[model samples]
Target: MTGQTPSHSERVDWLRLARTRQVGPVTFNKLIQRFGNAADALDALPDLARKGGRSNALRIVSREQAEQEIEATHDAGARLQIASEPDYPGLLATLDPPPPVITIRGPLVPDDHACCAIVGSRNASAIGLRFARDMAASLGRAEIVIVSGLARGIDGAAHAGALETGTIAVLAGGIDHIYPPEHADLYGDIGESGLLVTESAIGTSPTARDFPRRNRLISGLALGTVVIEAALRSGSLITARFAAEQGREVMAAPGSPLDPRAKGSNRLIRDGAALVEDANDVLDILHQAKRPATAEPPAEPYDPADAETGDGTDHDRLQSLLSPSPVPIDELVRQSGLPPGLVHAILLELELAGRANVLPGGNVQQAWPEDQD
Candidate 1:
């Protein structure tokens, strides 16, 4: 590693790579792995997109835009931290599609131990809210960093209870923009005492789709995710799914079956989520689980130029194998009778050209805009 941190140009490249259209978390990681740093990835983007079959020019964020975002975040008293930064949350960095760049407010404390995520319905019942608060407070006292989405009811209660010790609120919007409007004060408090983080650029507002993505970060940043009260189809369940996918523990607090909100937690319990009754239960589970360690390997140097292999025919074959329906990349390679790297390169080109969408589970599918269809 260089004695100096990555240069300003490199950080700008990282931001641009993150903001690039069709570049989701998985694709972003692959690009970084293939090209040593984001700068090289940015340089290689145009050709990559062309190989992906883009008829029109690809859209890449400009340096000016990234600079403006940096200024805005600094003006808001927050700073942007990339995944490889020292302050980046370790558990979150382990995620396959971890946020490449996150804006954070307040001091980024390094937890000596693993953190646990506590989340639930925004409209939690009185009892559920109290239970979440008490559990969070106990966890805080036990020196566990509490992590949650800064939503209403249970999430809010959890953060508030853990504030005295420490907590982290992962937001759906830009760090400067507070969502749900009503939680503006809570957001400020968190910025003061705890950590507030978001992947969105400055001034960006939360959309209907962003919250689920945010929930994944909440769960991804911890050793376990705890659902206090949630509906069966609520976003909390999505967090649980992400936790399970990332091989993190999923825990739920049971409630009376009579309440509609209880169904989510109860169902999770039935689905084999650890049954969490109190903070002790959480502590016990974490104690039995592996301790927090830096799981990332030392940064390896790479050259994007070296990654290029002449495989025009292979690219065409991979293109012919894709459909609107998402299919795992592994499946594509298996069916295409091509090397995995060649298949990946072809898909990367398609993605850059806006002709493909990479889905979870290493899936790649055709991305046909509504107008085109």
Candidate 2:
């Protein structure tokens, strides 16, 4: 939880701050903590970026643009939801800062309802598709919601099987931007019955980079992720990795070793993920593990005193110690011999300047020129 349910004006400010360039999920949290609210953070961006070594002012998303997004979302018959709302999924709400805002179509289920992600090869084998379909159908019958990236093959099959029940399609692009063009009918079906969720803004088409972020939401919304058939390089594995990092169950449907499509799932099994033969196996694990008691998102936001003011020399020294390789922030504090608060402040500024990357688990890395591009 981040703060109380936002008022109409607060929601607009939130959208603007989030849509601002170089303001990622992690930075969004840091900005809120440092500035006490999005409006203040929005006002501070120019000064902060200049202090962080930017020659020109940072491009903050405008209030007019934010307002247009709101209107367009309304026109689409969808609603824009902030993470602090009660309808926002708990599994996502508990993530650090969570997604600041998401555009959603259809109804949102309560956090207590079970959500399991089924993902695999977009070029799935017939047999693999059948298994995924059956598994999703069974899980749907048990009142579980299926979450998947609405790609072709296994994902489409899973949605089809669970159509009678409820499913959530997390698009790689905007909630209104349907990728793979062929799934337009399926997309409509979901909006009418299931839910369509996306962090991307209206009218934004997805690129290669968008899928990984989309994969994270697939796993984040679910209690577990199920891999039906994935090659060694399949994107489904990325979703499983996110699930594991999020402290959720990772389940895989075993496939024969001879099949290349099975390699990822098989390797996952060897690495200690649960082997799920069908939806029954998944339900059993859910029953046994049970959902952890989720803490409500904070009603009172944390405002860090002076978390953005830092010495320039000390900040440079800290930047010199970091590379693209992930290093713990605590280690940077120790090695740079800078005060922890100063280090945090410097990192926050660098992030807003697009000069840093904060990995999960309290790690930080330098964003190389290529990464910035």
Best lDDT among the predictions, by candidate number: 2
Estimate, for each residue in 209-287, the C-alpha lDDT of model 2 and write its tens digit: 5787789889888888999889999899999998887788999989999999999999999999999987889999877
TM-score of each: 0.88, 0.91
Error of 1 at 361 (Å): 4.1
Q: Evaluated with TM-score, which candidate comes out highest?
A: 2
**Clashes (candidate 2):** 2
Off by over 4 Å in 2: 108-112, 292-309, 324-331, 368-373
CA error at residue 325 for candidate 1, angstroms: 6.5
Clashes (N, CA, C under 3 Å) per candidate: 2, 2
- What's model 1's overall lDDT? 0.80
lDDT of 2: 0.82
> Against the true structure, what is every candidate's RMSD?
3.4, 2.8
| Model 1 Cα lDDT, one tens digit per residue, 99-203 | 788888987464555688999999999999999999999999999989999889899999988988888899998888876689888888889988898888889
Q: How close is candidate 1 to the true structure, as a TM-score?
A: 0.88
